[model samples]
Target: MSDYDSGDELLADINAESIVAGTKRDRSESAREVQLSKRPKVEDADFGSTGSNSNDEFVEHIAKTTLKENFGFDQFRHEQFSAIKSILRGENALVVFPTGAGKSLCYQIPAVAFEKIDAAKNGRPHLGSGITIVVSPLIALMKDQVDALLRRGIAAACIDSSKTYEQQQLTTAAIREGRLRLLYCAPERLNNEGFVESMKHVPGGIRLVAVDEAHCISEWGHSFRPDYLKVARFIQEIKAERVICLTATATPRVADDVARAFEIDKSNVFRTSPYRPNLRLLAESVSTKQDKFPKLFKFLREHPGSTLVYVTLQKQAEQLADDLKDEGFHVAAFHAGLKTELKAQIQDDFMASRIPIVVATIAFGMGIDKADIRNILHFDLSGTIEEYSQQIGRAGRDGKPGHCMFYICPEDFYLRENFARGDLPSRQSLRRLLEDLFHRDAVHTPEGDVIKLNQTTLGRTYDIRASPLAILLATLELRFGLIRAITPEYSSYQFEAMYNYYRVVKDDKSQEGKAIFSNAKKAQKWHHIDVNAAARSTGLLRADVIRKLNDYNDRGIILLKASGVENRYKILKELPSTPQEMDAITDKLYAEMETREEDALRRTQEVADLITGDACFALALAQHFGMGLPDGKTKCGHCTHCLTGARVVLPPRPAPSVDMVGIQKILDVCHVRDDPRFLARIAFGIKSPRVFELKLHTKKVLASLEDHDFSSLLREFTKACEAANFGAGTS
Candidate 1:
């Protein structure tokens, strides 16, 4: 061989050796391109920079230029400019701003700014090459954002179940080819392996990961979804370049949770005021369900404009929409059960002012961007203040005067409680099911025949039910290797043998008895092979086979799938006589259920109190979030309570007067001190709950007794009592 040929041969041998050694070359390392050099430094070139110029100055300057050149907006609202600057600096931030406060712009502008910076440094800017992944909880919101961006001539796309398989593949290709800049996806999609892999291959990598509705990540947050727990791991896996968590409602606790989830500095968190002065909060007590409709109708008739009527159930939403339509009102019903196309049409109609009133369930409003809504009416009591606030926040987005009214009936509390209970499974049922799944096994005969060995029948199985059994199947999928579970999708699974014995036996059939012998052997072979395959596929160990089989039967898998076969034997993994551990598990399950119930109840009460309280609406809301009011007073004078004389105050009062007749009348009629204060305190002069609790007919008599202001009513009442010869200790 020539010298050149020998050198080529040696190189080829080395490559072959590396391949055979199972050491695969890292694709990422191999694909690395030459890093571009930094731009040349300008010599005393201000670039329009001033003495006060900062990194943020460049960021803001770039953002403003992009806004005017791209989106055609002249200014940033509230903290939009600062937030975008923070994000561009690669600092994690939690932005708590009201709806329509331009939260999306915070992330969108920074993404554009970063892309521009890359362009200014290099000769060419790769549009949509800089990845900005937005993780939104609402599918509707994702669609809305994608559509809005596309309208702005921006390359944006969202991947959700609504897309067809071909469309998904096309979008995935678009992302890989760097044809899409902003990618919006639901949290569930983040867990998808293919989607994650596609993101890794995208050019420029993900520069920013923005989580919308970030409060959902916290257990203390009102709208807690268990799936949000996976977000941290997802960020870590993708090597999140930067994270920005945005929420309209977050208590200090929820803010902390968001910080922890995003690994953001707590000091970097920015929160806008939750209080909206334009929103007029009102609450009315309804004696019964019959009273709610009239009150709602009255409110609608009084203040008519684009409105959202939130109900708890689909049926209620539909029924109420019908009732409102009957009242000559334009209305549309929206719920999750409705067709997606229809729901979208309804939402479009509502947004376009084609439908003035959209009666909807909670599912409809998560991502709704209707800014002209003048009223938000709650058909029934909401489960929590967080939900109430979110629903009410839909209105007054345009800074116009809006009204929010709640018609509360005490019975609604029970209905909400029942709904919460329905989510939890009974401990006894779960324990029994777990006990069956944990202990099971199988044995095979020498002739490739299988003998059923378990409490469950080899041939009989049960049907799947929609109850605690679904939860059990989910637990099993996570713990054992029986099935794979996907949330908000397929909640259950079916057991099917992976291998086919018929194909194996088909080849051997020719060697069996030619006629009669062949037929008998085939029959025996079928029985043995079928049983053995079932046994092997179950993955149950030999000792616990019987119990698992029993569980399968109890769950109705055997009876439902494998009918007409019953041969089964018991195989215990270990002596199943540990009642103590079983009891502990049961206790734990019960405690969890109880905790959920308690949280639900507490949430209900808090919402109810907020609606009924006499304190300023803004202050009450701020206090709930652990924010103190500017002034120490309980009343803000800006809310309905302060505007009306119903606000309670402890002003200076006059000395006691001697009026026996009025004192006797007040004591005889009033039960609560506030009740008499409302009557005699304003007249005879008293300030107490008893006075208000009782409806004393002493307005005329008490007024005749004293001309003191309402503030001095209590002192006047005390003098009247003394004049009536009642002891100082007596009422």
Candidate 2:
């Protein structure tokens, strides 16, 4: 044993110990990851595939295997593995990732993972899912995903209004038969009676509900969908064990809103870093409209290979496409205003490389998964950083370098602000809606205070669009609990007579049935028998009548279809008794509308700042999404601002001044909404539910302050209140 040999031997032993210690540390880290990933199920059920286990390794193993076998991916990317594992463990997961970060794989892979596991154990794909139901807003997006899923040899389907009833029926059957690993439906599907019934019959069960574009559920989200509000209720109805919410673009507030709405554990809410290194951000200053057109043409000529030219309006898109076409580019226009077939064709052509450039509005790229987009050019401001993120995200998705450029001009604010303001109804519209729908008994009711609305008629009246009116009505329902239950089935029936309904009334064998039929047929059509009316006349219990109707329909005694069904609204809560009470409720809602508009405006201002600020455009935009720039990486060298060392110093915002007498007159005109903030909104001509009802927007009586900027008015009023040191907070 020489000294040199002993030293070498000791060093070898030390290195071996270090290796073992490191492996143990790695194992401990993996265990910690599993422990923190626990998202408890909303209820207990046989997950069938994700057996009861505490091993994170099992979930991770399944995720990797599913990814490779089903999605044909060698490994999970970013948060996909964690999200999928959380879902399979019956834990609620809310995941916010940037677009093209493979958010879809989080749910889609899990859908197949569950099915494969269950099938492997049972030796067959049986009737089961407690299945994965993906609630998406766009039919085209659903179709695209389903098409992709089918291509990957996964069982996936979607039920939407775009399909014929028969086609929807077939799709629904597939869902119920437990053959589908994933099913996509619009949020409106929750309101659909037939679809709801079919979902209830899912043999595998609706164990997991994945809400795509989860940001839509938040009123404060950049894009709010009224239908998204009903999703939580639908999930409750199905008693789903787990929920996984995926959104490509969500701010901190929007992410919090989604997690709270879905009852997902706050700790379980995972967000991928918003920073995308592959994208090169650029901002082009357009001092005039003229500068933008020539610059846009030059950029289009330079950047080729799947370019997206985003404009503010459909007309602008069409004009841009036309001009680009004349400039020798293969360009086509895409906007929601285009027919569905045309939009689909354009999307297809764009994906297949047929269309080199697409001139589109804000509606073009949501849920679109084309990978090779080389450039995205914003012809106008997108009104918000969220909008900008979502739009620019369409480019550089393929892990390839991509360019995103925005042409900024101060003059574009008018159109953008107008678009944001249009979403809010003037206070007058709200008052008229309240008067017609609630207070005045405008709903055609047979008896009692139950408000029965012919939806089409009420919706079309007073020049109110149906969608906006529905949102208002929904707001009333949610805020005040005014609308109790809304059933689209106006009629319920029980019939099983082989002979004519009139003759069936005399059958001794079917005496009670005959009596039921006799009473049901009186004044009411056989197919549209009002359950209450029939049960009352026949002296049978309402519950029994409903049961028999179900039996009869099942037995094919009489072919029952949902052809003439109309919506029936039950009023559980009484209307505001007096005009004063109604006014108060209207005023509160008006404040909400103002907040929504302000949200839009604030987001637009952020985008403006992003373009004009001297800071790295990527860093400014990334931090807007709550992700900090890495240390020592203060400047993103890829941005146009950083590259060119260009900066724009914006002029100081104008100071707001308020006229006390003008404010007092406005308060006198609107006694219900006395909050200084609410008053300020009105002073700036922001729409209000009650003030508009009072016709306060007219030329006289406090309407003269409309010329003031909304933000300034709000700031001045807030300051005035502080100066006076009274009426500080409404609450």
Q: Which segments of candidate 1 are over 4 A away from where they belong?
A: 1-26, 29-53, 123-129, 433-590, 628-638, 647-731
What global local distance difference test value does model 1 have? 0.59
The weakest ten consecutive residues by lDDT in model 1 span: 2-11
Query: In order, what lDDT does every prediction score?
Result: 0.59, 0.68
- List the lowest-lDDT window of 10 residues for candidate 2: 2-11
Quote the RMSD, in angstroms, for model 2: 15.5
**Which runs in model 2 stand beyond 4 Å of their true positions?**
1-54, 119-127, 197-201, 440-468, 484-568, 630-632, 649-731
Per-residue lDDT over 1-731 for candidate 2, one digit per residue giving the tens place of the 0 to 100 score: 11001011011111112222212222233442342233223123333445455245556777788888777788877777777877877689999888878888888877877765555446323334447899888776777889999998887877653443345446555654456678787776565533554454455456678899899888878778776888888887655667899887788888888888888887788888767788899887766666788888888778777899888888999998888888888899998787767887998898899988999987788777788999999888887788888888888878899999888776667566755665666576567767776755535343234565655555444434455666777776665788743434434443334445344334534434654565654334344566667666767654455545544544445544333334445575777767898788889887887787787888888888888987998888777777866664778788988888988554344334656677667656665332455556566655544445566666355435754565566666666556454564533
Tens-digit per-residue lDDT, 619-715, candidate 1: 7877777665555556555555656636332222244445556655656654333222233433533222222334333344434444333335545
How many backbone collisions does model 2 have? 12
